[model samples]
Target: MISRAEKSANYLILVVFAVFAITPILTVLQAAFGPSDAGGGGGFGNFADAWRIGHFGTYLRMSLAVSVSVVVVSVLLSILSGFAFGVMRFRGSGPLFYLFLLGIMMPSEAIVVPLYFDLRSLGLTDTFWAVALPQVAQSVAFGTFWMRAYFRSSSRALVEAARLDGASTRRLLWQILVPLARPAIVTMTVLVFMWTWNEFLIPLVMVTDENLRTAPLGLAFFQGQYTQGFTLLAAGAVIVATPVVVLYLFLQRHFIAGMLEGAVRE
Candidate 1:
């Protein structure tokens, strides 16, 4: 239905955008692996120095713990809540669903202050839970909305057949729906991992302990201490970002398919 000229124009635009998006990353990579001093050749020394100086080993461990915990808790809660909202009928379901939708509409900046105070009141400040819990809440909100849409749009005939087979409600979800929802689940997991991994503001505000710092927060402090060392800084940035990049690379196909499917349904 499209002309060759239009297709060419679209391709040109996409290529331009891709270059725009990739230029900064390429620049970072160059600086990360480029010459460190006046005569030294490029190598991994900068990364080693950065890692040691920044105490990124501890920061990385903290990040992994929080991110993995948030993803597991958020995904499980999202699945249960999403399934209920999508397929089950109950009193006040519409209102409750709308309440969860409000979470997606709310920005973190708007609630982070109150959230910090509340956590502090509970003596959860300066703890890993301080950083992880709020993010889990936020991720679960979006995940529920995402999975609910997926379930709601699933084939009614398939659900009916499951029911006809005398499958219990739990079995219908886990044995039948869960397998079919693998793409959506994978997509949500990737998204939650990326968000939780990259979070900064919550950790910065809630945790005062140096050991509890996450990668992004640690990178900020590292930058402050090594403001003049561009090579080390670049390497640190790459180290912080590599996990999410690798994750996306591995899940690109499933993520793209899930996104496209969601779009088509919408």
Candidate 2:
């Protein structure tokens, strides 16, 4: 049914967009491997030098810790709360759901100053919890909204059949519907992981200790203090971005399937 001309046009558009998307990354890679501004080594040697000087090993581990903690806590809480709001009807539920939405609506910039003071008063600043807790809160807000939508759009006949088979609410949610919602869950997980991994501001405002600094924040300090050249800086950027890229690639199929399923469902 499709004409060859239209198909060719679509391919042309995709090729153009792909090139546009890939050019910057290719440029970064070239710079990352090019000569150092200090007039010395190049190639993968720059990455080695940058890694040694930047302390990326420490920063990356801290980032991994923060991102993992945020993702796990956010996903768990979001599932529980989303199930409650989506599948169960209760008093004041409407108002409570809106309260959760406030998290998505609110910008971190609006509250970071006061949030810092609150965490400091609680003696949580300059610690791992300080960097992670805020991000967890932010992720949970969006996660709940995302999970709630998936659960609400779920198959009612399947849920009814599960209930009739004597499945408890928890079992129905965890065992039945949750498995069917894999794509949606994976999509949300990828999003939360990416956001938490790339988050810079909360960590910056919450912690001052060098050990507590995450990769992005560390990259900033790495740029300012240790590096005076473009090569090392580019290499550091590549190092910081690698984890997120690897993660997306690992989950690419499920992530894209989920996004497409959601689009078709809506």
Candidate 3:
């Protein structure tokens, strides 16, 4: 148990960190809605201008497509692979899982140059699949690792009980285990969404098509536009960030619960 003084210190530290985290967002909001000079406008005006100038509508839609595809495919594969690794033991399973560990350990920068050439050789460059497929692979690698740990730590007694009741493997996984793993699943989904949404290098390297540009890439280009000012830039940042922020808030309870659960398990 924590002492009163320790609890107070913890609260103080949390407050400090909270303020630190919020400060930049508050500053960006101020700049985003700040008064404009010359012929420009403030508040919604900057956002509107930024949206139009940045072509973020198209960029965001493309990003949404990639993110959704990556999340869905990767998380599903993660669940299946994780279940196999965590719940069942088989020959060479340890080495194969360790091979996946390489994916998590190796940075994209190391493989990206070769990957781009490989994709080009396969004639997949400048396409939606080009931008999304690599990310899917990367996300799956991490997601597998993540979900495997969750399943491994899950209540084996419950699993045994389900088995004794004549549950099929499919029923056991989808009906019994998956429901209980909601918080963990949601946590992984949130993480993958954030990662896929923010991925720059993959999309940048794979697609040169303007229509395939992701939000971050678009923002980078938007910032380069000479006519755009600081307010507009800030507004663009806010726009790009809003979806992930909303997602995290919507899944906040589950995400936090998963984090705490992982901590306890660790």
The top-ranked prediction according to lDDT is 1
In candidate 3, list every pair of residues with a backbone clash.
Answer: none
Q: Write the per-residue lDDT of candidate 1 for residues 8-40, one digit (tens) a residue.
A: 999999999999999999999999898885233
How many collisions between residues are there in candidate 2? 0
lDDT of 2 by residue, 200-263 (tens): 8899999899988899999999888975778888899999999888977898875566556433
Deviation in Å, model 1, residue 172 alpha carbon: 0.9
**Which consecutive 10 residues in model 1 have the weakest lDDT in total?**
257-266
- Each candidate's TM vs. the true structure? 0.89, 0.88, 0.87
Against the reference, the lDDT scores of all candidates come to 0.86, 0.85, 0.85
Badly placed stretches (over 4 Å) of model 1 are 1-16, 38-41, 254-266
Worst 10 residues of 3 by lDDT: 257-266
Can you write out model 3's per-residue Cα lDDT over 231-256, one digit (the tens) per residue? 88888899999999898788887656
Among these predicted structures, which one has the highest TM-score? 1
All candidates: CA RMSD in angstroms? 3.2, 3.3, 3.5
What TM-score does candidate 3 get on C-alpha atoms? 0.87
What ranking of all candidate models by TM-score puts the best one first? 1, 2, 3
**Candidate 2 residue pairs in backbone clash:** none
- Per-prediction backbone clash count: 0, 0, 0
